[model samples]
Target: MILERQNFMNINQISAELEKEFTNKSIEQEDIEKLQALARLYQLYQAGANEIGTKLENLDAEFQVNYDHNPIHHMEERMKSVQSLLNKLVKKGYALSVENVRAHIFDIAGIRVVTNYIDDVYLIEKMLLNQSDVTLMQRKDYIAQPKTSGYRSLHIVVSVPVFQSTGSKPVNVEIQIRTVGMDMWASLEHKLRYKTDIEAELVDHYGADLHDYATELSGIEIKMQALYQKLNQYKN
Candidate 1:
């Protein structure tokens, strides 16, 4: 316990020094308090992501036991780093304060749910949204209307209350639901567009090819969905 307390004190000292450096001013009690609060807020966001992940896992388990089918193939959850959050706030012309971050940023925590079939995406979405605690703040149906770059997914921003020592605080989390095919194309497309250094004309050529590939993937996903429905028609 003594060692732990020493470590904690050292961490606090480091945090205060870092804050002072960033602000270019002497650290005061009020600033220390604000920094602690900001740290708690990030912890809350990570807890929110974990809460959503648990909900998705539970739903998948329920489907498997009750319906003999599992909709969710896999899930990925992430929390935005402090640097990333600050960068985004600056890019969006928002003030660099905890208050502005809470008010403006809704995607500090994110989850991506990948399903086997396209319809499974909607099924999981409906089930999740039906929960009372999950409040839908925004919905963007890119699957129905694909992006110009051929990215397709159902994006939803939701607020879920996370219980804390003080009280229950509502936290925002962004959810993306898509089929395996869509996820595959999106992953590769992102790499090609962002990681490569092809010339302008070649980039255009690759872009067209990627668009065509996305279309083909969509068609394949639809067919796979139909096949799944036919196979499980009598099971459920």
Candidate 2:
């Protein structure tokens, strides 16, 4: 699958643009400070996400050596852009403050883990969360209870300590674990959902179709998992 990387503005560029935005709107000094603080917080978020990704890769390496199979297929990490963060804050009618950003936005540092099989998703989740240093803040098992749109993935919010110049600070990171099939469906669904110049009716139609497709793919994943288990049993 061809995954497109998200484009984000440089931190300095974002800060400059935000200053202009505040100047145009005549926002207060406190609000400006809030925006600046949020930008700086993102640096810490990026570091935390990178730390988690590295840990996962190390776990995969151990599994490959001991079990001869790696559960994780590929991992993708992203830090939320300044414009995206601002848009979310405005949409929720929340003030642009560092405190509000930490309170409301759980996915500022997002990571996606694509696995080879359905069971591998859960296995990796269990193993990762069982680590001594990793703290699992929240978990949403969409595979067991799928969304209305038929989206299926295990979402986990974890707080990992990031040793910064100041000191050790626990930073929150959102991890999304899914099978390859689920990832493929979600990737296409996201593109279709965000396509411009498309009629509203057509978009709705496509969304419904994607939901049905997701359901079918989920069924296939279950059968594949069963077959894999049987094969392992036979091998044993």
Candidate 3:
């Protein structure tokens, strides 16, 4: 029987511990970041794994297999998260630990599909393997690539391993996908986003720009989605 990582965490324990963690003296910003990181990762792990599981168990036409770079024992890993993050911290130790913050410490990433057709999702997700200081943690094909207005699809969750005192375990990540049209909108929105939210005057000034790009991207997504559907039919 396959041991599920998501299976072990008891909601009751998590809730009780969270309450306990909060109640004990002070809570720092970095501590909150750690909590949020864990929550996001756990959520993605379950959702993404379930998605892969469905494709594996329910559907036989397409193939889905574990993309294990190195075997992570489900039970052992769970123990690490629980013992190291949840249980080990005390009033002073947790506070001291938070002081050591580093970039590349945490990452959320996704895989995208970037082709004209549905078969592209499969072929690219399957064949485009790469080498270097890289690990293909997970693959999700929407395009299978970045989109135009920048509306994209497909989400991948990966554990990017980092060498820390935390040992050799890879940190989890999430990735998103978009088509060319969607990506264009998204990229512009990202460029524009920095300006609007900062200054109300800028929001008034650039609000139109954001709306224009969003509408354009939404439209692009619609047209491209139809193309994807048509492509799917052709494949069938």
Candidate 4:
């Protein structure tokens, strides 16, 4: 789980640092200038992620203080690595330039918000998007329509202003909201399918098993939500 880092980098120093980071990665002298531009572009993305992260944190704090509940369980943020950015762009048949990256890559800055209950997932999304400055660019409700891989979550691409000395730049950030149960299943599935060298036949066999497990987890999540509501009602 990556957290926000200090994104202030001297433009003059970015080239040297980027060179060091991508050492022996088949980078040419001409590409250094382009990479520097990308580094500066990523700074805005980092700031955008931090802004949204702060908003989510503040909302969670407010919920705890005023409503005696915390909708967000935890959050993880990450700025895509340079290699990853390049790979994605190249794989998607986009030119490896800052302009193309900004135009095509929506998940350059990503935040995963995990909540305790399924209802809290939608609640947090509603609260975050209700802000005047946050503009909804795109939304994919995978919870309602699970992916073929049995993946489920609400993915929202939002643009938030990252105020700089010059002006306010609307930077895009991808936010994924999911309940603990959904997260657990997704994490496990990712590990099994991606993190290992499992054979395709085995993966196909376990894919159905994973989907069944996800369904079971979903049932349990609903039950837990019901119990939580009952407990809160009883306390009130």
Candidate 3 wrong stretches, greater than 4 Å: 1-156, 160-168, 195-199, 228-236
Residues 1-236, model 1: lDDT tens digits = 00000112233543554375468677778877777777767777877887888888889999989888889988888766566777888899986668998999989888888898888889988999899999999999999999998899999999999998989999999999998888988888888878888887887888899999999989988887788778877663
Candidate models: Cα lDDT each: 0.82, 0.84, 0.42, 0.86
Using lDDT as the measure, what is the rank order of every candidate, best first?
4, 2, 1, 3
Candidate whose TM-score is highest: 4
Off by over 4 Å in 2: 1-11, 26-33, 233-236
Better of 3 and 4 by TM-score: 4
Candidate 4 local lDDT, 179-200, one digit each (tens) = 8788988998998888989899
Model 2 per-residue lDDT tens digits across residues 1-236 = 22223354456765776676576577777866766776678877887888888888888888889877889988888888677888998998998878888888888988899998998998889888888878999999999999988899999999999998899988899999999999999888888888566888998898999999999999998999898878877653
Q: Against the true structure, what is each candidate's TM-score?
A: 0.87, 0.88, 0.34, 0.89
Q: How does residue 192 of candidate 3 score in lDDT?
A: 71
- Compute the lDDT for candidate 4: 0.86
TM-score-best of 2 and 3: 2
Model 2 RMSD vs true structure: 2.9
Clashing pairs in 2: none
Candidate 2, run of 10 with poorest lDDT:
1-10
